[model samples]
Target: MNVPVVTGETTEKHPLEDYLRFDRLPHIWCPGCGLGTVLGAFLRGLLQSGLTPDKVAVVSGIGCTGRSAGYIKLDSFHTTHGRAIAFATGLKLAKPELKVVVFSGDGDLAAIGGNHLIHAGRRNIDLTVLCVNNFNYGMTGGQFGPTTPVAARSTTSRTGNIENPFNMSALAAASGATYVARWTAAQVHQMERSITEALLKRGFSFVEVISPCPTYYGRMNRLPTGLDQMRYYRSNSVVRHGTNPNEVGVGVDGQIVTGKFIDIERPYLPSSGDGNNGG
Candidate 1:
């Protein structure tokens, strides 16, 4: 007999209870959405980073991925749309000792919050940014987003999107981020390891996670299910460490180039008025 997961209340403790909120038992992501898997990977990576739970803070913007802040047990904030990075920057500036992380989707981070993303990278602030890219705005009726691949189909682009998507890792590296990497949800182990490394990195670190919006992008583009997308990723992804990030743009039919593109030591610019060091 299959038992339904009890949402509101239950005595059974989950293995991740230490880092997640039990009260928010069931998440709102769709059946095939990769948010849960991404969240799980993040939690594991957090543990691997060896940072004290209390010393870490998570910030998320308005979007499906924004709900992550509410699910985490540590200090977290659900901020305005496209403002997760801004909020995280503020948190880090106010409390430099804290390890701040911005967790949000492509639309929230790369679209509305695009300027903040770039400026933060330019400053090289000591922060880790985990961007979950589902290729479209899954929450807002599957509209084409900043990371939506060219020629990909979405509700807004019924005939096929014509706009070129932003190569997230490339943008991060160009903006002076000290660490930049890309991975898909299908590559969970590597993704988790990358997240941990980003957390441990001293300067601005960005990790772009290609996730599945099976309910939206998949249906419009023929992937249809999370399994299909994962299979595609596993089969089509090419792991090339140090590949030119600009050449790693993912497309509807092109191979997904994944790996750490940059990891260079940069001065961590403290937000405090007196520092000449680069962050």
Candidate 2:
């Protein structure tokens, strides 16, 4: 379970081969999708945190981001839709020694799995949750979702979405997550740093990753490409560490706020097992 240092510059063998399931190379993600970038950042963050892959277990619910669990070479699970958190919670209680991470999409985590997401935070479970917010349900025809901003176009809301999106970081913090952060795919290294911090921290931790679903979200909103989405992030992202999560809800073409909004000590949910701290 030795993880290799990836310089990320080599193209021949690819620096991150050790972390990926090469048999599944050439992922199903569409051209210009940003999942690959987010995945790379997660792997690099895990490596940088000095956590051995064998001790880590990734869980995911059904969605485009759910494919993340299948792509990682480490012990993983592809749970039922909106059930990744519930599964991960049970896994943690059964074997608290293993570090469990729930990697899933905003639609799956926020819209369907939202109850589990908040309860896990309320109890301060020893888990790291990475929610990729692509602004729509990318895997299911690109419809408007819980995080779809007001006036944003989607297959279901072509004219414009009138509902307001949830501030995920705020939800996590309010639900009692000990660590909360938000970053875009364009800020890879920063996202990696935040992932590393979340992994190393005890108790519930949540990181909301704003990614590009150029195939759907971008196409409906006029971005049309991953690079265009990245440019949009560059132009709109404002790093405001410690800002109130409640004030950072993204809007249609609004300022993309990014930061680690909360970090505080809390008692993690206790497990029946011995010799394993809740984190």
Candidate 3:
């Protein structure tokens, strides 16, 4: 089957700047936070996807990254904490033609919203999820979350986090997402491609972006700036995809993996007009 191609008329702009609201300049994210980088990539992806602002819906949960929806000049909805996925599901089902994208933090999706995340994938909802995994919960004073590395210090875990982190791409793939990818903020070009493909995918699509929380996570981990943390990923990350869980456990400090882990076609939820399964 021919995948939905994303193209547009030629224009003399930054490609991404055309779709963004410049007046909304000076976003709320803390200085050195990688969420801005992720947002820039998303805008570029949307442009490459050939999705008009009116036809797309960007939803977000509560967090520093959740504030992303506000900056974008598109149809956006800021929902309750950890409920962005649930809200996006309903939006996609109600308007099957609309492209829905959920931007959230690791804690919002993996901790409080984990159940919803899995269920959405299992049901094969036609939606794209961009999960910015900064490891710690930066919005709430840098507490350890599901994506926080083991032995990492946080406000709650002053000594160190004893729990393991969740590999979001693997989790989504296991849960039945048709498209799953993992990338860091350092890989801006690759992340743009992942987001482009995810929006066009028929079933659940997830892209876990390893963004840097320089303000909190960085201060605790000794990486003072988001740029410094990005440099760490650039130098230490091991780019590969589809590796077994046992092989990539705990992501040793220096090895950050980046690639498209899964890209298999899956069934989307039945529309009311489609026959067979009652809608």
Q: Give each model a TM-score.
A: 0.92, 0.93, 0.89
TM-score order of candidates, top first: 2, 1, 3
lDDT of 1 by residue, 161-208 (tens): 999889999999999999999999999999999999999888899999
- Put down candidate 3 lDDT per residue, 1-279, tens digits, no spaces: 445354676344555675677788877788878888899899888777766567788999999988888888888888999999999988877877678899999899999999999999999888889999998888789988898888888898889889878878778888999888888899999999999888877788999898888888878887879888988989977778776533554442768778887888866784442211111
Q: Compute the lDDT of residue 121 as modeled in candidate 3.
A: 90
lDDT of each: 0.89, 0.90, 0.82
Better of 2 and 3 by lDDT: 2
Runs in model 3 deviating more than 4 A are 1-18, 249-252, 271-279
Please give the lDDT score at residue 4 for candidate 1. Answer: 47
User: Per-residue lDDT tens digits of candidate 2, residues 1-279?
Assistant: 546566776345656888899999778898888899999999999888887678899999999999999999999999999989999999888887788899999999998999999999999998999999999999888999999999999999999999988889999999999999999999999999999999988889999999999999999999999999999998999999999999999988879899999999977875434212332
- The candidate with the higher lDDT, 1 or 2, is 2
Lowest lDDT sum, 10 consecutive residues, model 1, at 270-279
